[model samples]
Target: MSNRPYIVGNWKMHGTRAMLAEARAIDRAAERLIKVEVALAPPSTLIHACRKEANLIGIGAQDCHPADGGAHTGDISAAMLKDAGAGFTIVGHSERRADHGETNVLVKQKAEAAIEAGMGAIVCVGETEEDRDAGKAEATVGEQLKASLPEGEAAAANVTVAYEPVWAIGTGRTPTPEDIAIMHRNIRAQLVEVYGEAGQEIRILYGGSVKPENAVELLSADDVGGALVGGASLTAESFLGIIIAAAGDDAE
Candidate 1:
């Protein structure tokens, strides 16, 4: 992947087949910006359709079960996501942890499943506002990364880590550029400790209120390999703005 900035849009629970137009538009724009890698993790319902509609931008699923197939009832497995044309899946997102009660062990299993099914995994880890206030933000995120990442070869090969502060997500708030730089540096150190030289190849992304206006500054931060965008990614115009920011940074 050349370590190009990997800008991924997580549509969350939004998007239907109707939004495929925006996805196609994003894909078209991605084609022109070959210096950056762009991807979208849409709701499961549109994964196949979006994959079918786009040829450039990577298509991914918002979540997936650890098991291949079973009586999990309503839960889609990693294999099914791959079958649906997803090249990747995002696991352990803060929303899944809060709303679905997903534990770190389970997130690790899901990430392993994604690797097993031949898909990339974007594993998320973050701290809450309270944790930040209590001066535990760094330790909390470091612990989550240790617990949530897959083991052995999968750890460095298939996973990308995203740090999204729970309070900042969808709240129109973000860590200062210095704070983001510090966090990413901390994450890079942990990854290197665990995976050795291969860890340097692992992409660390920053999420939470990543808009086009601020994308350049954030993407320029030390060790910030890319972004895991939220609302701003809903529209191609908006998402393309971030991608352009990344491309510009890469050029510089």
Candidate 2:
């Protein structure tokens, strides 16, 4: 709400209690900075535990089922996440899109469920380097955003969008800042079209290969609100550097 960059660390399949010690370390390292809003999405198994130990930081879940009631064994629903103290949920992550074969339509339903459950939805969208090289990245990502985002235009406060290039995720390679800027700017334009006036305020974070070293450049780029770190976020110091990098008004 403050226009501060909402930096979120996606601890994808990479945290245990000992790792939560690293989360606590993050709490300590970032305690003094009121400039950024930080959140961590751990494995769902750790959400409740994370909620208890969250302390000055926000805790999120990696995924959720579309239905409030379901027999989908091993699937946690949005209501369950809210009950577990998860303040947000990362929906349509690239891994979920690829591994689970989630379609934009399905992701839209899941996001609606999270919003109905009263938690923020970090909706993710991105394209492959191949798509970028072919100059179709913007078109592809724009289509995904059109399909996945709610048509009625949910409030910006309850939502954030993340651009996590499938090619860069976990590959240790990143898009050049210029490309990143163009894509993010494209995304903001699309959002403004879809959400009308409120979309300009929605946080649009850049994910993939986000580390302390590259975070400053990414955070400073136009339309890039923050980051969704994967590997670097496993540690406290690295993740804190990112949060600190995103400090201050993102709109600035």
Candidate 1 Cα misplacement greater than 4 A, ranges: 249-252
lDDT for 178 (candidate 2): 88
Model 2 C-alpha lDDT per residue in residues 1-252, reported as the tens digit of each score: 356777888989987788878878777666777778888998988888888876888899988899998689889999999999998899999899989999999998888889888898989999987898898999999999989985544545688899999999989899888888998889989888977778888888999999888888877778788789899888888887787676644312
Give lDDT: candidate 1, residue 140: 96
- 1-252, model 1: which lDDT tens digit per residue? 356899999999898788999999999878889899999999999999998999998999988999989889899999999999999999999999999999999999999999999999999999999999999999999999989988866668888999999998998899998998999889989988988888888899999999999998888888898999999999999998999989994533
Show the lowest summed lDDT stretch of 10 residues, model 2: 243-252
Top-lDDT candidate index:
1
lDDT (CA) per prediction? 0.92, 0.85
Prediction 1 TM-score vs. true:
0.97
Please give the lDDT score at residue 222 for candidate 2: 80
